[model samples]
Target chain A: MPKNILSVENLNGGYEVFVGRRRVFVHAVDDVTFSLHNNEVLGVAGESGCGKSTLAKMIYGAIIPPLLVKGGSISITTKGGEVLNINKLSIDEVRRKIWWIEISYIPQNSMNVLNPLKRIKDQFIDVFRYHGIKMDKTETVEHLRDTLTTLGLPPEVINAYPHQLSGGMRQRVVIALSLVFNPRIILADEPTTAVDVVTQRTILSLLKEWRENNKSSLVLISHDMSVHAYMDDRIAIMYAGNVVELGSSLDIFKEPLHPYTRALIESLIRKGDKSIRKGLAGQPPDLINPPPGCRFHPRCPYVMNICRSEEPVTTFLDNDRYVRCWLYTSSR
Target chain B: MENENMLKIESVTKLYGYGILGLKKFKALDSVSMNVNLERPKIAVLAGETGSGKTTLLRIIMGIVKPEIGRVLYRGYDIHKLKGSTARWYRKEVQPIFQDPYEAFNPLRRVDSYFYDTVTNICGIKDKDEIMYRIDESLRFVGLSLDRVSGKYPHEFSGGELQRISIARALLTTPRILLADEPVSMLDATLRVGILNILKDLKEKLNMIIIYVTHDLSTAYYVGDDISVMYRGTLVEHGPISKVYQEPRHPYTSALLNSVLEPDPSLRDKYPAVKPSSLELKEFLIAGCRYANRCPYAKEICWTTLPPYIDVDGVNVRCWKHLDYKL
Candidate 1:
């Protein structure tokens, strides 16, 4: 078997917030087990509040107060062949040793990620400074310029403030900042959702090119199925914080096993197809008090009686595909 | 000429500027003209990349922004110059459904209050029973009901549900024309289709014309009967959806179509790859064709003079390449 760079075994994460006076726990990421192989793009797709972002945050080991790591651990095999369980490490240790060195996260919105007041140069230097990595001023400038140029951004972007650039350009600067250390795995959460189609294509293509050149693994998270279709080698379909379906992009699109996955693909409005597609009936489950048994059973079209009582375990299928649905697996 | 139940835009132009004395001006919309008054209601998609001024054109059509030149005529009354009753009539006749459904309403207030506000004011209904009936009728058209949304705030519903509510509110007036601006762009794929289907049902059942403005061609193609491809504040191509999708006459239209990543695995890599062009704002300032700088087939004349609209097989294409070309 190929050495998987990042292996997440039964990862569970969620948030704790008070609704009124009572503290309610929001189950966001629940028992999500998937591995990221080297040089592959793994896409996680779900609707808003499905906890795909929370899952990415957990994987990046960015868990904070209120956002508790309820259970499970994330294992990573660094370039130096050191195996580390990220949950065991302290936040400071993870920050200095892992962040931007082993893994980097590109958030959904660059406007929120970037510092509006500082120049792009200062932002890049700040990251290295926080990590206690000293570099010559000219050398750092030259390296930053090289990365910007390679990503099809002008070198002058380093001197410009975040407000000076457009949304797309600012996103690229964030990406450039992320790539400064050449992390082995990059977790991008809805990177292209904020930009226009042309700019989105440019960012995706550039990221793909960069990944190919560096042989890095990418966990591309987006709600847009079209983006996943073009970028992902494999996909994990999340519904109500559970990995309902996992398979190759081709198999996922062509032969989706889970009913939710089927609905997702069916609901897509493709070019040259004029059929009256529709949204799934009912709202996405409330995570604070998700439905018993299968989280999707409330909205599931082919939901059986068993699906309403007992949750189905992951059923491994041919071609490394797996699905958590009563239709695919027998209930215990 | 009395063109009743018709919507016509005649050479509309809008400009925006920021410089010394506001001298450095750029055309937000440049003489863009389109019309839809089909005997049977149909959706006409205004599609383009961002900064293409498709939204600007929609705003003009909605009468939210007045164009510097040209006129928007709805049933022969100039949209911007309607009198008191005529303005209210125009408002009832033409309604706009905005993007960001959450922003469509006041988040702190009950979602149905906006419904009552519209039905009472613009729709001119005051009786609580009559208001509920009108709101319920519109809501049911979008697969929702008044009771479900009556006591609910904006945050209580999902993005899809709120969007449907907004669409229902637009339907409250029973408007002849619906100007939907990126109705489904904010929703997830599963929810987006439902909204599109609702729009489709409206045109067929309610006999209402919808001008669907979207950057996404896939959704546009799904709901659109007529398609007008815009590029940098100008309408480059306008024709039937089938004709335009199959044979895009304008270079920008072709590029826009090619750029759309169709959600089919089999048809992957079937179309030519579209290179992402930088300098997005510069296109609006181009004196000639707005798409000339990025057009692969851009000729010398494409750089100097704006290409006039040339008719080709029932499709109006703005490109010099189609000039004097036979079918």
Candidate 2:
């Protein structure tokens, strides 16, 4: 069995936005638990409002204003066999030790995060400098060049501004920025979403190579099911701030247990497919006032009485397959 | 040929900085020519990558941008040179649904007001009863209603709902050709199918020709009757959607179809690794074939001059590789 890299327990968090004067908590991620293991890509798949992005932000400890970390314990196993709950640590401590060194986050629109005015080389250097680690300038340049070349990008991009490069190039540069430290864990939130199909393939393959070489666990969040199928080793389906299903990639895709998972898989239309595929006949739930009991019950075709009134417990099937559905339960 | 009710884009070429000063120059859209028969309704997908000139072509079709070389003829009339009444008629004949629904609407104004304004202004409907009726009919076509969007602002609705409202607004004019510019790209994958279904319905039920613009081939295959594949501001290949998807004539088209990751995990074929270049800006500025830099079967002629559209099994392919075979 592979060793656990990070374990999240009962994680609950949301954004608190003001509604005319009263503050309301939009439950983005709630009561989610999962363990990410060594050197596996765990895909988080769901619709736009399903809180997968929130889960990524929460896991990164990016607790900015309006986004409140209500409760959760994120425990990480350090290299020296030390178990530390980084969530409880100060922002400064996490920034100094946890970020870039241990974990890296690649956002969807990385161009927004990167300084538009600064050259790409300066951005790469700023991350190293932020950790207060003094390295020789030539060595840092060499390291940056190596990372870029490894990702199939030319090293001359270091001299160009963010706006000068195209969308796909910028996405690769962002991934390169995150890989500077060769972090043991990477959280990539739709890194290839905005790029074209050709570029998407290149970016994802490069990402796979990076993961393989570094032996790192990657958490990829994408709304497209095909992307998850192409990249993920394990899959987790989130709906209305809760993970409705989790399992190995082979088992999950071979036989999707959850009704929502089934619908999502069925909804995809391939290039040569002639049959008519129906979109799910409902909207993604509003997290602010989500449906009670099972969040997916409203849309679930096989909904039961128990599914409406009582929240279904996570049933652990053989081979670590997890499902949250009344139909899967023995009692039902 | 002149009497047929069809859209004739006669060798349209649009270039940036053509008559401008001190601006970096490139062709926004190359010589793109195609015919859309308006006798019957169908969904024609303008499919391509980002910066592939799909949006620029749509903008040119809508008269938002003028072609530097050729003209767009709709129903045997030059669209760009129409007179007052003909232009007003042209306005009523063509309508566009932009990519971003949130940007299409004014956040400060109520959503229904725009519907009313479209019906009143462009549609030229004066009576309040007639305006409401037209708005309700169009809204119902998109699985929405006047009541649902009566008092809602742009921010009050979901992306899907706002997109539906925008579609409803476009339908109020009863456009013969509905231009959708990447309508589903901003939408979630699950919800985008619903919008695609709406486009299909428009073709089937209302008998409207929809020029559906998108980068996703799957959804394009799902909705399109015909597909025009573009690469880097040039139309690379075009044919019936199913045929083009099955056996892509152009190399770029084949590469595009190859790259789409199928949802079934068991069918995860090893995707071909493409080495990306640092400077893709040269693609736009290249005089010959724009995809010549990446195309596998490029010859000497491909670099010096652009190839004419060669007919291959009813598909028009813009590649020098097919020239010898076609001849």
Candidate 3:
């Protein structure tokens, strides 16, 4: 197996997302631990307000004020076998070494990254120049042409402005820009949320192609489970800032250990299954002062007394699969 | 076309000229008709991607947009024909819940003001106490109380809470039918079900016919009784939710079903990467079928002539291949 390219241990972050004098802060992410293997796609599946985006920001070192990384560390293993601690590094160090070169973050809104005035090819050159890569204009053009062609994007789009391109084309351009530096890991948060189903599929397939060709690990975060099903190798289910279930994509879908995961899986519409998909009753708990024990106990169908009193420990259910639920606490 | 139904959309066709400079016109809705039964009030999901005229259909039903040719009847009254007080009554009968809860209410105004305005103006509740009582009951029905949301701004509450409040405001009017346009698309998945379940409960408890317009088929399959697949403003298929979902006779319907990426890991290989075709305005106004370009089952006749609506096993499917084909 390839070496673990990314390692996140006990990562925690909170944000004062809303306006309040009560000093209300959403404990968006708390004590989350996961690792990304080389060429592996880790799908982070959760509802909105679950801190998946916040966690993505923390990973990419994109934390802007009001959102602070209180504790924990992110360690990334470089190609040279040198491990870099992302959290301990200064903003300058992160910018010079991490962002765009070794790691790239694809935000939910693809338009945000592209300058409306600049041509798509100019943006590509800007990314390359920022990384201090020394390739001539002709070489750069050739590289971009090959990249876009491989990704199924028409090469002629490089001359088009951000607005001239469709939403799907803009999204593809952003992904192509992220790949300009050949980063080791790509952090994509809801990249396919706003696009059409066909566009979403194209973008997903392109991402899959990128992972295979470059041997890069992908940390994809999306609320749509179906999007995760399309590209994810392993799935991590989150609720109220807690990673309740982690397992192979097949295992999580076929045999979900956590109540939240089970409900989420059951809620999705399957082709053959015409039975009414029952949505979970009640809302996700407020992250400000989430329930004392398990944050999901309020909405969990198989809630036990202990689930209310104490948080369950992560159990090693099977190979590489971890679940935090009372039902899986004991063996079968 | 009037069938004791809550809403009757008969051969509704909404056409859009490609502005002054453009040469062609776009057919956003192509003689698409549907009968929504009020007696069995349930969610009738009008599933389609963007530019499918789902929003246009909702606007036409709400009397915001007039169909070039066709009629939208609510309770035996042609919505377009009604004028002044009669149209006002029709508006009160059919209410709308927009997708964005944050934008639905005025940011400067308190969320409760909408509730009061809806109660007093639509329901005609004159007394202050009576309006308060009505608002309180509506709020309670959506699992929200007046105390928690009475004097709050849109930003003060979470997306889920604000959405619930939006539902409460819509409920205060006590409309017979609620047209929700992608109500849960903006919400988080965990919070989405809350809003979806609320709609489900409201359907049973209040017996309200819901014309839910959305692109997400999963939630549509979850709560919808009847399903109607719209493609660039054309109705491809419509029938019982189970039959349409199970058999899916229309090629567009089949493509949509196959495109849905499930969270399930085992079914990874089931989905084939397919992109939505970029449709031009002129393509929509084509002589025959709008989907003929992308449809693999398209025949020579499909390209030039419109396919007649054939009822196969009780499900209405508008496809040349399904004309002789039965499930």
Candidate 4:
């Protein structure tokens, strides 16, 4: 059996936005739980403002002010078989020890990660030196040249500044910087959102190749279902800061259990199909004060009276699929 | 023949980025031509990625950017030559719906003020009651109402709702041609179809032409009647939507079609390797095919000479493979 690399249990986190002197707390990511095994790709799929990014941040241990991890724990089993609770560690400790060596994070707008003034080679060298990895100028240059060429980039790009490259090339450089340490787990949040389709395909393929060759795990978060379909091995559908459905990628796409997932799949305009695709009527609930019962109940087509008053528990179905909906509950 | 053509673009070319010494020039749009018929209103999709010049072409059509060569003629009158009331009239006839709904409206101002201004100024409406009446009528077409958005600011509404209000504002003038540049790309998947449905309904009910520009192939296939594929400032393929999508003649069009990942996991392994070109500026100034650097079937001839447009069936394709064949 494959060993679990990272396991998150009942992770509850939120952002506190202040209105004048009054502080209002928005529960962005509530009770998000999932496990990523060794060498597996887990996709967290959701629309914007669904807290998918918050969940990734919490896992990567980014707990700055205004954003707090209220409850739950995240455990990562390192290669030495030592379990590290990310929440218990300090920000500096996480950055120095765990981050970029065990767990690396690539944010949504990764193109802006590079410093404009610095050359690409200098940035890579700075990261390594900060980690206390001593190397001379020739060694650093040789290492960067080999890595960039291996990642399908020309070595000459190391001498150029960030603005000299296109959006896609800059994104690749960010990816290359993240992979310098060969972290066991990578949390990539919307890595391909801004680039064009051709560039997106190439980046995704490069990521897949890297993961397979290195035997690492990846948690890919994106709002595009087609992207998740192409890259993910296991899929988790998030709605209003909750994981409404979790299953294998193939099964989830072929037969989605949750009403929100089904509606999202049906709404896509596919080729060779002339039938009208209908969008869901209602908007996503506000994370600050989401609906009481099930968050998706207001827009669900199969909503019941009980669904309006009580939240449905997650039920396990065949083929390792789990869904949070009244339609699949045994009590119903 | 003149009456049949609604909009005619004749060999339009746009250049960008003059270097310090005025030597470097990036050709954004090569010699491109197309004609839209006013007799039958249909959605003509201009599909391509960034740097493909789809957005530049849309801007040229809206008269926002001036082309260095050729002219855009609307009903036999050159758009660049129009002045005063005629230019204002042309602006009313062709409206644009931008990609971001949040950026479309002023944050401090009430969203309805834009609607009111569009009705009064662009539509040339006078009298207090008539302006409100026209605004309400257009809002109703987009499944919105004046009451819901009358006093609300832009921040008060969600992205989807804000986009609908933007569309409602666009409908106030009853534009003859709608240039939508990635209108639904920012919205959620569940909300994108609603906006697309509204566009389709407006095309059929109002008999208006929609020039939809997006990098997405699926939405293009769903709503487009005619499709034009652009790559690196060049028009590579043009034909009926289904014909071009199903039987792509140009290599770039085929590559673009193949790049669209369907929401099906069964075909995951069928994805072909796509090599993205790194030298964007160099490719833009290439003498031959811009896509030749990455094309799988590129030959020596593809790198030396620019291929002429050849008519295959009813579609026009720019490729060396189809040059010898005629419909």
By DockQ, the best candidate is 4
lDDT string for model 4 (A1-332, tens) is 66788999999989998989989999999887888889999999988999999999899998997999999999999767889999999999889878899998988989998999999999998899899999999999999988888778988899999998989899999999999999999999999988888889989998999999999999999999888888899999999989999999998888888999999888977765668989989878988889988999999999899889988888888545788888888654
Q: Output the TM-score of candidate 4.
A: 0.97
Better of 2 and 4 by lDDT: 4
TM-score of chain A of each: 0.97, 0.97, 0.95, 0.97
Interface C-alpha RMSD after superposing true interface residues, each candidate, one decimal: 1.5, 1.5, 2.7, 1.1
RMSD of each: 2.1, 1.9, 3.4, 1.8
RMSD score of candidate 1 (Å): 2.1
lDDT of 1 by residue, A1-332 (tens): 55699999888889999989999999999999999888899999999999999998888999898899988989999889999989989998888778899999998786568878898899989988988889989999998889999888878888988877778888888898888899999999999887777788789888988999999999999999988888888999999999999999999999888999999998888888897776788899999999999999998889899889987888989656899988876543
Question: Alpha-carbon error at A278 in model 2, in Å?
Answer: 1.0
Candidate structures ordered by DockQ, highest first: 4, 2, 1, 3
Q: Tell me the interface RMSD of model 3, in angstroms.
A: 2.7
State the TM-score of the second chain for every model: 0.95, 0.94, 0.94, 0.96
DockQ of each: 0.67, 0.70, 0.42, 0.75
For lDDT, the strongest prediction is 4
Candidate 4: the clashing residue pairs are: none
Query: What TM-score does each of the candidates earn?
Result: 0.96, 0.97, 0.89, 0.97
TM-score of decoy 3: 0.89
Docking level of model 1: medium
Better of 1 and 4 by TM-score: 4
Taking all chains together, the TM-score of candidate 2 against the true structure is: 0.97
lDDT of 4 by residue, B47-104 (tens): 9989899999989988989999999999888998899999998888889999999999
lDDT of model 4 at residue A242? Answer: 91
- Between prediction 1 and prediction 2, which has the larger lDDT? 1
